[model samples]
Every structure is written in C-alpha cells, then in structure tokens.
Target chain A: MNRLMIELNGLKLEHPVMNASGILGSEPEHVDILVNAGFSGIVTKTFTKNPRNGYPPPIIVELDNGGYLNAVGLANPGINGICPVVERARRHGKPVIVSIGGSSLSEFIEVSIKAEECRATAIELNMSCPHVKGHGLDLGSDPSMVYTLVKEVVSTINTPVFVKLGLCDKIIESAGKALEAGASGVVLINTIRAMAIDVYTGKPVLSNKYGGLSGPPIKPIAIRAVYEVYREYNAPIIGVGGISSWRDVAEFILAGARAVQVGSVFMKNRRIVYEILEGLEKWIEIHGVSSIMDLVGLAHRV
Target chain B: MFKPALKTKTEQLSSTLYLAEFKLVEPVHSKPLPLQFTNIWIPGVDEIPMSIADYEEEKQVLRIIFKVVGEGTRSLRDRSGFFGVKGFLGNGFKTRGHDRILFVAGGSGIAPLPLLTRYCTIDNCIVDVVWGVKSSDMLFNIEKVALNPGSVYYATEDCSYGFCGMVPQVLQYIIEKEGVKWSTIIAVGPKPMLKSICSTIDPSIEVYVSLETMVKCGLGACGSCVLKPLPKLLCIHGPVFKCNEVNEFLESTHD
Candidate 1:
C-alpha cells in the first residue's frame, strides 16, 4: 500500500486522517476506527486546567442532511484527567495531537506545558470552540489576539503548534496572522454558527440557544476557506468540516489541505473513517497516484 | 450491589416501553436495591442511564424497564440484541431495618418499587406498596407486586382503574384507613409526587426519596448528575437520600 505520511512542522504523521477537537473525548473511544482506517493521528478533546461541567442539557441537536449542531461546552476532565488517555494513545504508537483550550492566556500556556510534560506528539490550540461564551472561536476571530496567543503558545512549548481556526468574517487574514505569530500550521473551519428550533416547545433545541453546525453542510465552506488560506500562506492546512466519505477527503486535499480531520461523521457512523480510508486507498491504487502530496491543490491548477 | 452479566431483549410491550434483562455477570458489594440504576451503551446510537427493576439472585439475572425518552433509548428500542450495559449504579434505597416499610411508586417509577417488595419478603419485613399512573392504559403487569396480597395498592389519576387519586394521595389514605404504622417511607416517582409525600408527612417517620438526576458516566466522573442545593454528585452520593438532605431543593423545585 502507498504510504499516506505527511509532515506538519517537525511532526510526521502516517496519514492525513486526524480527529478534530471536542468530537473525540479523552479516551478517543473511537481510536479503533482511526487505527483500522489508517489514520495518522488522533486529537484528544479540548482540555483545560480545571475540570469543566460543560453546558446544560440539549447540548447536541440534529440538523438537515447528516449535519449536527453541538454545544458540548468543551466539557473535559481537566488536564489531570487527560494524562492517562494520552499515555494510552502514546502506547498505541501513533501521533497523539492534544487539543487544548483555556479561558485565559496563562491557562492555555499551562495546559500546553502540561501536555508536553506527558509526551504529547503535538499541540493543537483550540482557539476555535464556538459553543463556550468567551473561549475558543471567540479568541480566534481577532487577528491581533490570534497573533499574540499563538506567539505566546509557540514560544512557551517545544512541540509544534497547530492553530485550529473557525469560520469567521476574516478567517483568511487571521490564518496568515497566526502563521506569522509562530503557528506551524492551521486547521481550517471548526464549525459555522448555527441554531435549531424545537417544534414541540417552540424554542431553540440547544440550551445555549446557538451551536456550531458541522457535517456535509459545512464541507464546502471549509474547503473554500482552506483553498483561500493555502493560496495566501505557506503553512500546511488540516482540512476539517463535514467529512464523511473518501470523496469529501479528496475534495479538501485537492483544495490544498495537507491532511483532514473528521468529526460529525464519527457520531453518525463510527466506522465512517475506516470506510473513507479504504475507499481512498482503492482510488489511489487505481489512479496510480504515488503520493498524497500530488493530490494537494490539484483542483486549483486545473 | 449488582453487575450486568448477559443482556437480553424481550419483545416490546408498547411503542414506548422495551423489556430487557441482564444477568448478574458478577456479584457486586450489596444486594441490588430498588431505584438503583445502570448505564447502558448501544454502539453507534447513544448511551443512557436506566434503573434496575428486578433481580433473581438464584438465576443471577437483573431486569430493567425503560421508556424511550430520547435518542439513546429510541435506538435501544429499535435494535433487537443484547446491548452493552453497566449496572447497579447510584445509591439505592436502604430499608430502615425496621419491621414496617411503605413504598410509594408512580408511573415508570413503579419499576423499582417491586424490587424492594421482593427484598422485604426475603427479610421477613412487612411491606406495603402504593403504585400510581396517569391512566389505566399506562399501567402494566402488576402480578409481581399483587401476588404478595394485602401489601399492594394501585391508584390512577383518571380513575379509569383503582383508587381515584395520585400515588401520594393514596399513600395518605392508606395511612389513615389501614392504620398502618410505617416505620420508614421510601418514595420514587415524579419530582412532584416525591416532594408531596415528603412535605405532607411528619419528619419523625424517616422518609427517603430516590432522586432522578441527569447522570452520564454513572461513575461520578461526568458530574452531569449533580442535584442542586445539596451540591453533591447523585451518581456518587446517592440515587437515594433522606428527605431532609435534599428537601430544600426537592420541595422548592417540585412545588
């Protein structure tokens, strides 16, 4: 089989498939799927210094098509709670990307440092969680803040820094700013802002009133954002948004993403990652594609 | 305590109810008590917390009754197989070790009350049960509790079947007419029913209520099942608590 290995800063992954933050919890209970599917890495759910209770009920809701609205509120067991899971993934011998978030800059630095102490392969700054009030996506929306945060994080940690970005008004410019601020790469389009109404109650389905929309609905938007950023910057792109099949993975790669992250599809079909990888390998073999790098930005040249 | 061994799905009785039994694959610390729950996980669907309704120690089998409340239970109802279940979760009712015990159950709440009655029979303790539902159609097999004789009472709000009142009302009537002196009262049901029974009774009687909180991990790791005012983990501190410990929040919210 042709190798799907790709380089992200100093880290080399066996394949492009990585679990997005928040979707996969500490145990990455779905690691079996990733391992069998030929995924290169798995990112743990976003962790903070203190344990978080997340949001109240109605945290998840289904949308049209295979899309979903989730406001899991970054409910994590804290940094202490994630250590054992990280060690387990390390024993599995695959790259473990620790997705981390914090309410303040110092908290973020502390989480990153703690993760490094546990021998995490890489750190993905989850400055793109759209559910929580003041953390995540709110932090990524401002260019100055992104720069300051990424610079501080990159300087403090010895590991490679991948800034996970959200879909905002000026994400392309923001992507450039993060790279310049010492980010090794970027994960594009966390989720678009969305909401759903309960027919019976005549109220919003989510307790938070709003959530991040993911699944096939956001794939095109994520691809476009990745293409635009790839066109303007030199940093590698980790394409994420509505990826359920091999074709969706290919679309992101052709649009210039070096790798891809799958989230919502895992909820619908735990085996979707393996299914997509199998299909990708079959297509590659038939098409005589020697490397994944050949697929990056192919659609753009044509 | 009880742990799930083998999970089996019996035929569905109605659109909302599914009857499933799990054998105690391993004996836990204590005997399975009434109103104690377990967390069940159905792959690719959802994971939910459910209550243990009956246990046959001789057969090493534990039974659970559940109503399809959300995506998790809905999926369990759809699938016909032995799904994943983790059991005897949460603190269950502790019989006061007294001679006379009264158990009040409402709606699906009746599921666990029978387990307590079964235990009382084994202990040679006197047991009286008050079971209630909104209507007769919502009722199900009561032979298990009824077979005990002179120990069970049934009530329905619509008066389509037995006594024409709620479970708490029936309990009050039983105390007045039967002249039954209950050394300890255990109530499990809707928040309103449990609250009413607690508030109307004298504190000296020793009342305990099985509270339903939104439990996730069942191991106290999730912290989703915390009861307010008490500021304690329901999955850890209790699924069963004295009325006084949770009275402030339970009474205020339910009323």
Candidate 2:
C-alpha cells in the first residue's frame, strides 16, 4: 500500500484523493472531518482579502446529470477567516492546500502570505471561478495576467503554489504560463460558465443570472483538459470535477493527473471518500499495478 | 435514483403561501424530528430545501409548506407528478428536557411548529404556540395548532387575524397575561422575527430558532446553508440553533 503514495513537490500523500476547494472547504470542523475521513489532502475554500457575503441564496441549481449550476459568488471569510481551517488541517497532519481568490495581484499576494503564515502545505490560486465579478474567470481568462499573478504568488510564498484554471480555449496556454511563472502544479478545470432558466417565470434560475457547472456533466471536459495540459506541458495536474467513484480517479490518473480532487460526489455522502479510497486500492491490487504512478499518462502512451 | 414522493395533495393557503403533502415510496425511520427539513427536487426544474410540516409514520406521508417567492417554489407548485424527495435531513429540535415549551413562528416558519408541539406533548411537556402571518388567509394548519395540548395564539401583520402585531410582540403579550414562565422557546420565521425573538425574550431562557438559508445539498457538502462569519452549517449542525449560540452571527446576517 505504501507504493500507492505519490509526491507533489515533495509533499507525499498516502492516497491521491483530495477535497475540491469551495465544497466543504470553508469550515475548520468540516475540514477536520474530511482529514479524518481518509483524504490524503484537503483544499480550503477560496478565501479573500476581505469577507464577502457572496450573492444571495437560491445559488445552486442541480442539473440532470448529477451536475450543479451555482453562483455562490465565492462567499468566504477573509484571509483572516481561513486561519482556523488551515490550522485544523495542519494539526491533523493532512496536507492543506489553501485556495486564495482575489480581485488583484496584491490581494492574492496578501492572502497567500497569510495562508503561508498559517503554515498551509500549499496555495491554490482560484483564478478561474466563473460567477464572481472582478475575480475568478475574469482573472484566469488572460494568460498574461495568469503568468503575472502566479509568478507574484509563487515568488512571495515558500509554500508550493498551484493555479486552478477554468475551461477556456487557451487553458493549455494558461497552464504553461503558470508553470513558467514557477507554480509547482496546476489544478485543471474549475466549473465551466453556465446558466439555467425557469420557463414558467421566463427568467434565469440563479440569482446572479449565471453560474459555474460542475459534476458529471463537466467530467469529460475536465478529463480532456487534463489530457491536453498533461500532453503538452506534462505538468503536475490536480484533476477535479464530477468524480464520484474509484473508476473516475483512475480515469484522471490515466489522463495525466498525479492526483484528483473529489467535489460534487461528496454531496451525497462524506463517507464516500473512504469508499472511493477502498475501491481504488482494491482495483490497484487486482489490476496488478505495482505502483499508482505507473498508471499516470498510460493512456497517452498507447 | 431519488426515492419518488407522491404529491398526495396541494393546498393554496394564500396568494404567497402553499401547503403540499407527499407519500414517500419508503417510510422514514422516525417522525422526522421537529423542524428538520428535506430537499425536494424536480427532475429538470430545480431543488428547494423545505421544512417538514408534518409526517405520519404509518402512512409514510410527509407535509411541506412553501411560499412562492422564487422560480423554484413557483415551479414546484406547477408540478403534478411525483418529485425526487431526499429527507429526513438536517437536525430538528431536541423537543424535550424542558418543563414548558413556547413556539414562536412567522410566515412559512410556522411550518414546523405543529410537529414540535406534538413531540413536546409526547414527552408530557406543556406546549404553547404563537404563530404570526401577514393575513388570515396566509394561515394554514390552524387545525395542527389546535391539536396542541396547551394553548395556541396567532398574530398577523395586516391585522387580519388574532393579535394585530408581530410574533415577538404577541409572544411578550402572552407571557405577561398568562404569567407563564416558559422553560424553552423554539422560534422559526424570517430573519427579522427570529432576531426580534432573540432580543425580546429573557436571555436566561433557553431559546432555539429554525433558520432559513440557501440550502443546496441538504447534506453538509454544499456551503450554501452555512451561516456567514461563523460558517456554521445550518443543514448539518442545525436548521435549529440555540439563540445564544448563534445570536451574534444571527445579528450580523441580513435577511
């Protein structure tokens, strides 16, 4: 089972499963639960320089295929608010990836420093959140800005940095810039921009009028993005989106992600993390794969 | 697959308020605890979190009351077929360990009080209710309120019903008139009413309030129902919380 351990810039994880940022990532107690639940790592919600109330409720709309369209507006406690979550993650000995979201490079730098100060294992810059104004996909869409932002945060923080990018035509280009800017890894495919409508009312469903799509509907797109990014840059990719089962984890690894983050699937049950980990381990043993690392990029070779 | 819930009946309580009953394909383990809620989803339409108005353990029938304030609830009212219902979710009231329990609710918050009253009665505690609404027409489940063993009071903002005032005002009025020293106060309503109840009630008395928030996955996975600042999950920790535990954060939260 030790052979299942994988390293991301010297941070070794017993399992390649992690909680996706912004799911149950806001609270320390919840993070503690995830840590004890068998995830090798946990990503905190995207914290900002100041607390944001986010958009008003009725934020989530469940799509047909286990997908969700949400415009939560990245509501989170400020940089100061995430310390407890980071602290709990640190105390539990689980690698904590502090996800930071800001409207500016300076805001990103400030929040990253605070996370590093809290002793987070890594920093995931949420440059690709689709629903928020003046942040998220707005910042991630420009490859040059992605390069500059990643470089500044990477330069400022001693903790390893990863850039989470949304689906865009220039996703590979964005990943390239972030890596060139000294990011330790890339978290591919934040939710894709999408919207839903209530025909009865003849109006948009979400309060913000738009949201990001996640879950199984976005899984294929996420796999494709990870495949393309890994094929071109061969960088460390943390795959996320629509991962519910052990097989999904294997697919991400085959697509070149060293590890995968599970989000929406946990909506049904948190204990599913253990189910996924157990299933992955059993599959690994039965398949006669000597090491989990051998599975990475296997699809690309054949 | 979502366990199918049959829409046994739907009643329009008012222009805004509605009562809908469903029979679950599978019965619940217990009468869903008082004020505990369920997530109701229509295949392609949307999912909305609602509180249990009543549940019959034998019949496997559950009741929910909703206000048609948004597209989701409006769409819910239009649907006739069986919907996907995920329940017996979220923490409801404890319903015991008190001598006398007083329930204060406003608008759709009145949905859960009847069940809580029933539970309190089962535990042999004195149960009283103070329900407020915008008008008399907005009131449903008057029969449920009547079923309580102790007393039931009503207040309406438009002066169309019992006491022509808000819930807290009538609650204060009842305490003064009946000379009842309540051991517990369980309040449910819009934010302002809950805040008012918090401020007006004796700080020494044990008080709990059922919260209304954007509940996504009724399980704690989605952060939608988490209160701001504290990040306490309303879906998990409670749709019910001690007034003192959440008073400060509740004060800071806008309706």
Candidate 3:
C-alpha cells in the first residue's frame, strides 16, 4: 500500500512531500536534480510575463536560527520558457506545479494560460511571495483583490488552481476569500517580511533592505497559520515553512496540511525529502494508520 | 554568514585591475583551501563573487584581484573601504591525480591562480603558469604572490612582455618546443578563452576551468549560479569543473 500517496481534489502525487517553488527548479537540469532527489511533485520558480534580472547581489542573508531572509525579486525565465520547463518536469512522470507571479491581472492570466497549455498538472498563483513588491504581498494583503484574482484565474483555465499566501493581518480571511472564489487548494505561508543590518558596514544586509524570512524560525508561526486556516473551513492546505525533518512533516499533517512543500532546508540537506518520506513511512506504520490522510487534523479532534 | 571586514586596502595592480585586501572581524571556517571563493558585498551597491587570490594567516587578511567593470567594483576600489564578506563558500579548483599541473590564466582570470599555485606547491607537485594579459601593462608583478613556482611565463597580445603572442599560442609553443607533457591544465578566463583552450589543447590532457557567474547565496540554496547540462550548482558542485563533466556549459555560454 502506498500510504504516502496523495490524491485530493483532482491532484495526485505519489508522496506528500514536494519541492517548494523557488528553491531550485529554474531550469530542466535543476528539475532533474529535484526529481532524482525523490520529490513527488516539482514546483518551478515563479514566472513573470517577462524575464527579470532580479536585485543585484546581497539578495540573501543567513540567520542564526537556520533561516534566511531573501529579496530575490521573483527572478525567472519569463512566460516564454514554459514549454521546455513544463515538458521537462512532465518527462519525469511526476506532477508539476508552475508558480505564476505578476504585478497585474493580465500577467497572471497570460502566464497561467501558457503554463496550463504546456500540460502543467496544476497552477500555483504566487499571491504571497514576500520579497517581490506589487507581484505578491501587496496583492495578497487585500482580501477583496484575492477573491477577484482567484476567481478570474479559476475561470480562465481548466487546471486546478492553488493559491499561495504570505503571512498578513488577514491571512485566514484572504485564504477564506480564495477558497470562496473557487481555488482548488491553498499553500499557507510564503515568508515573513524581515531584514538585517551589519553593525560594521552599518547598512542593511539585503540590497532591498526588507525581504521575506523562511526556514525554522517561521515554523511556529507557520504551524499556527496552518492550524487556524484548516480549522475555520476544513480547507485542503499544503503546508510550507522551515520544514527539515520527518517530524516536521508529521507536525504539518497533524495540524491539517494535506501535503507539505519544502524549501530552504534543501540548502542544508538535498536528501532531506527522502529522509522525511522514510520517517513518515515508519511513523505511520507504528501508529497503525492506513494512510497519511487518517492523521490530518488529528489535533483538532483533541 | 557575511561579516564586515576591516583594514581593507585597495592597490592599483594595473590600468584595468586592482587588488583588495581586508581582514574579517572573525575568522572564517578555514582558509578557502584549494581555490574556494567569497561573495564580497558592497553596501547599497552590489555584491560580487571573487576568487581568493591569497590569504595571510598572521594578518588574517583575504586577498582578491578584480577588474573594475561596473559600479560595484568602482565603489570597492577605494583605498580603505568597508564591505561584508561571506565565504570560503563554493567548491574551487581541486587538482585531480596529475603529476604536473599547468595554470593558464586570461586577464582577470588570474584571480584564482595565485592561491591555487601556493596549494599545489605545498602538495609538492610540479607547477607552471602561463598568464596572458593585453600587454605588459596588464602584468602586475604576479611573481610577488605566486612564489616558489617551477616557472612563471607571461604572454601578452601586444608582444610587449615575456612571450610575444596570445596565451594559447604560447601554450602550444611551450608544449611542443619543450616536448613536455602536462597531466592537467587548469584554465581560468573568459568563456571564449577557456573554450579556445579546450580546442587548442590535446584531448588526453584534462582541462578544468573556474566558472564565474552571479552567485547569490554562495551556499548553493539559490539557483542563481546554476550550470548547464548536468545542472550542477556552481557554488557547490564547483566554481571549478572538468571539461567533460560540463560539456554543455562550454557550448551553451558565449563570451
């Protein structure tokens, strides 16, 4: 029995662990590396309508808590690169989710159509990318805008739509609005807005000054975000935040994440996903559970 | 982790090239052994990747030679400058099992050659260098840094220095005239130069090139410096790679 298998709302994955968008997956070779590492799904870097060179260096800074603050500015190959990227990811026979980024509605709509036409298994609207302005946090912070954009994108394509949101004052409300607008699922927690300063240089570490923080430091917040979102509507949530171990996966599952996307941690351990899957397999075998689904929202019952 | 560097010194090596030296507030993991790199951050401007030309343990100084190409280098070329440094990051040149190693440097590509030569000399391997510059003006007394070399030869395009020709031509003459066989050739330079060397040298001789790309997280988390074909992250797999391993990288990139 493939206890780790995931099949939810028209989306199917051999395992619940996925490679989070933007950690890698910018090119076909990067995809091959992730696929070979045993991820059930491949999430490509978020794409804008045109190529962006991104911010000049000093874009990422490491924290003591095994986290990173980065303002990559949504650097991508632009929409025209969809065919080769989607085709390569599909070649591995795994589900591919192309993350879309844009400042306005047309860009999102245009990229989604191209990604969908290239046979992407699903489309992930990057409404929560923290580092890039106008493209993400600004769009996600507005609940009414979330509803409108999600609805417009949902009506434009036949592929399942997953809304990725960052942590904001009205995160739960925005997530509610997305689901209400016909989103198939939600990816909770992109990154928290943060920055660092060098005492010597006396300047902010990242060139953009403010960037999104990811990795272990945000776990507690991400867990609470996932917990609250799942409780409010019993919505299907894909958890992502500072996940590095099988125990982390178990935590997200118990908190109601149907599957989890991993980022940041890959920088430390490329094979962490396999370790997580193995650990999940062993944990479920011990719990006498038939599938990971059985453990979803177990915390809510308590 | 990038910390602020102190006592930074910038010396004009030539018209186009300059050498910057600074001491980190705290020691890095270890001296970037073999030929590792560091991402030097210029505040409010840009952070660029530089190969460690030399490091002095007594003074705790990190030395790098760079060309002033853009605003980043222009701001960094001050006599006493302040910046953040994070490294000994990325895998640098690792000498394969070769008895004799020849380093071929093209212009600013000479950045990694000094430290590489020092390490290889300690390993007691026969080492030779053929550094090609635009003219004698581009040669900046390299012997001062690359000491104890079996021999150091300079090749200038204008024929104003040691050898009167481009680096590849001098390389061919050296190989044929001396009837000497090199087990390995570590070439660092522009894409066209590295590619040309690949075509000029014998297939039996192994060629390893240090690739320069925009490296963001130096730790390999960001895909900013990803290489082609095998798709190895240059920060981790290498800033240095053998010709065969990254065949597509050479063919895909142009000068």
Candidate 4:
C-alpha cells in the first residue's frame, strides 16, 4: 500500500499521478471528470486575479511525433471562478492544487490566499508559462523576483506552495531561491518557447507568432531539469512535460520527481491516467520495490 | 491515435475546394461513421481539422474535402506523400432509422453529404440531397451525390445549372412541393445558412447540423471548440448536434 501513495511536501496522495496545469482543469466539470478518471491530484488551470480571454483563434497546432505547439495565452476564468472547481475536487478526496499566474506580486499573493481560503491542498505558482509575455518566463527567470513572489504567497497561505520553474539558464538558482523563500516543492519544465511557420505562405503558423511546445519531444529536457534540481536542493519535485505512459512516470521518479503531472497526452486520451497508474503498480510489484518514496532520486544512488 | 497515412490522390474539385484521399497504413478496425473528421498534419506546415468526405473500408482509403482557407490548408493541398493523421474523431450524424432524409449543404458544406447519402441508401432509405454552390463551375461530384437511388437537387446562386438563389430558398421550395414526409434534415454549411434553413424548416422535423470551429485537439480537452451559450465541446459532445440542441448556438453571436 505504501508503494502507491506519494507524500508531496507532507500532503499524501493516493497515487503520484496528477493532471498537469492547463489540460482540462479549467472548469468544475473537468475537475470532476479528471478526479473520476483516477488522478491522485488535480491542478486547476492557471488562474489570474481576473478573467482572461486569452489569445485569438488558432491557439494550438498539433505537431508530429505526438507533440503539440500551443499558445493558449493562459485563458482562465479568474481567481474567484475556481472556488467551485476546488471544492468539487476536494469532495472527491483528490488533492486540489491551484495553479496561479500573475504579472504582479500583489496579484499572486491575493490569488494564493484565495486558493488557500477555498481549501486547496496546494498552490502551484505558475511563474514558468513560456508563451505568455509578462506573467510567465519573464517572472520565472529572475531568481530575486521568484523568491519574493513565492515568499509573499507562502507567508499568506497555509496551503503547501510549489513554484513551477521553466527551462531558463538560471533554473537551478531560481529553484534554490524559491525553496529558500519557503516553497514546499517545485514543478520543473513548462513548455519550451517554439514556433511553426507555414512554408508555402512564409508566415508563422500560430496566431500569436510564437507558442510553447510540449509532449514526447520535451521529455528529456524535463527529466534533466528534475535531475539537476533534485541533485542540488533535493526539494519535493513534481515532474511535468511530455509524460504519456507509466514508464515515463518511473523515469521521472528515478530522476528525482516524487510525483508526475500529465498534460498533452490527456488531449489524446483521457483514460491514460488509469493506464499509467496500472503500469506503475505492476512495475512496483515486479521489481519488489518497498514503496514509491524509496524510488525518489533512485538513479542518484551510487 | 496518431498514424502516418498515405495520400493516394489530391483531386481538385474547384479553385477553392480540393478532395484528398489517403489510404490508412493500417486500416481502422471500425469505420469512422459519416460526419466524423480527422486532424491531418502536414509536418512542417501545421495541422487542422478536416471533415471526412468518404471512407472505403476495404481499400482503407479515407477521403477529406477542404478549402484552402489558410496557410495550413494551402500546404496540405500541395503535399503528395504520406502525412500524419489523427482521427476517427467527433461524433458523426445520427442516421439510425430508415426515415426520409434531407441533406441541405451550402458551399463546401457538401463535403459530408455524399457519405451520409451512401449510408442512408445502403439501408434503402429515401435521401434527398440539396447541394448549393457558388456556380456550376464549382460543382464537381454531382454524380457522387447521385450515388445509388438518392435524388440530387442543385441550387447555384448564378443559376448556371439548377435552382436560382440560396440553399434555404431551394429547400423551402422543395419542402413545400416535394411534400415527402421527411423525418430528418441534416444541414451543413455556413452558420447563417444553417440558421436560415433551421428557421425555414418546420420545428417538428429533426435536424442535425455539422458545425465547424478552430480545433487544436480533436479531443474535448481544449475549450477552443466549445459552442457558446450551452458551451458543449464540439470535438467530443458533437461535430453533429440536433438542430434543436444547437439552434441557439447558430443564432447567437460568436466571439
């Protein structure tokens, strides 16, 4: 029984499987469906202080090799709108992690408190969404800003706070600063900034002219990021990006992620959660691993 | 869910519309019912949702008809070799009974009609197809529309060949004159055209409309294709909805 349960910064989950932010976590109904689909935890879509309309049409372009380039621009139904979704997820006994993004520290602090007040088990500070301009990479790349933002939110909220870091050059430094500022965990590697241009038309394919790329293409990068972060601070890590199967979950756990969040693959089939959970259970049984906690950073063992 | 399908042919239906047929590398065990669509990825260009025009189960060939509306479609039209296709997506039209069927298609909306026509004829049901195009030159596959015993009605705005004016006017004339106790009306076209036809047709008759919107994922995950007011996800809930189910959607203003 211990082999399946994962404790993320003291919050215990039935399984390490969680829905990555921004897949189908926006509405209350989506959260209910995701919980019913068997994810141990559910991350609500990134919420801002107010409602955001997001980018115009043509926001997502599916790539070959089971990947996608999307510029959804973080279209979320404000902070207040997420209360019902969080409440619904909690009713199902799934740990509800609220993902919040904002351009200002006050906005982040306000939303984080709202999430905690709404009974969110955790809050994932989305300081790493790459496609959005002021709210994502710009805020994430600066270690000092991340430290201050996480510090303020952590101080105000009782819920465990996790800072989702991007693939920036200063990721290690940023992760360290976030942990020092009181973030209980870190979710590594948001979508990498990418774009696709139409060869015939000689123009960018995405309406935003740029988007974030996710799916199988970004798995290695996510793994490496997790490995590097765990090597240094050994903080509670939730690995995301390009995770599709149970093997990927094992890989992330081996690389130091205590839990894994799945996104793009859910776009292919919502039932993937059951498959991944089933595969993990079988793997633990065959390998005679005592528990999933023992497997964290197992690859780092000499 | 994603497979590399072989493009066997790209036939030009008109200056705007093109029909490209691809033979699935491995045949789908179950045929994607008529009105279901596929997401065709032209590698370097981009991927877009295209309505399945027809499918030959034995040959494992899938036909998709699309207009070169954007850069993606333009690139897709020119491509010749194999491309990745993710499909058998969206719920197809509900043609369950051997009831009298009327297919009202406007412009390139004729894409899915022939397949539905074929499905209905196999059950020996009476199918009346009313296809409206800009002109006679745009008409390419009237014969395919006439497949088996179904009657084909043409309405072109230019009066180049059939009834003059739009699809709804011709449909109104047919509904009043044919007096064929039609049970179902499946209309696919521009939103305004669908609205007009829905308004023109009697409320007692069941109508199914094939809707189009910007689709990123063929699944219901993305909220991109949600039909407003009711906010139904088109990819999963329907690309096909009874006219009454989405009658408000057709009339409402889209963002």
lDDT minimum window of 10 residues, candidate 1 chain A: A24-33
Q: Note the clash tally of each candidate.
A: 5, 0, 0, 0
Answer with 3 or 4, whichever has the higher lDDT.
3
Candidate 1 CAPRI-style tier = incorrect
Candidate 2 local lDDT, A4-91, one digit each (tens): 7887777678889998987777777677567766788988889999998877545665665678787778878787777898888878
True contacts kept of each: 0.00, 0.22, 0.81, 0.17
Which has the better DockQ: candidate 1, or candidate 4?
A: 4
- The positional error of residue A201 in candidate 1, measured at the CA in angstroms, is 1.2
Candidate 2 docking class? incorrect
TM-score of 3: 0.95
TM-score of chain B of each: 0.86, 0.91, 0.91, 0.94
lDDT of 3 by residue, B83-157 (tens): 777777777765545678888889998887677767776676767888899888888877766757667788899
Q: After best superposition, candidate 2 residue A200: deviation in angstroms?
A: 1.9
After TM-score superposition, the amount by which residue B218's alpha carbon in candidate 1 deviates from its true location, in angstroms, is 14
True interface contacts retained by model 4 = 0.17
Residue B217 of model 3, lDDT score: 73
DockQ of each model against the real complex?
0.03, 0.18, 0.68, 0.18
TM-score for candidate 2: 0.71
Instruction: State which candidate has the highest DockQ.
Output: 3
Top candidate by lDDT: 3
Residue by residue across A31-128, what tens digits does model 4's lDDT show? 76677678889899999999988875456766656788888889888987779889889788788999999998999988988898899989899999
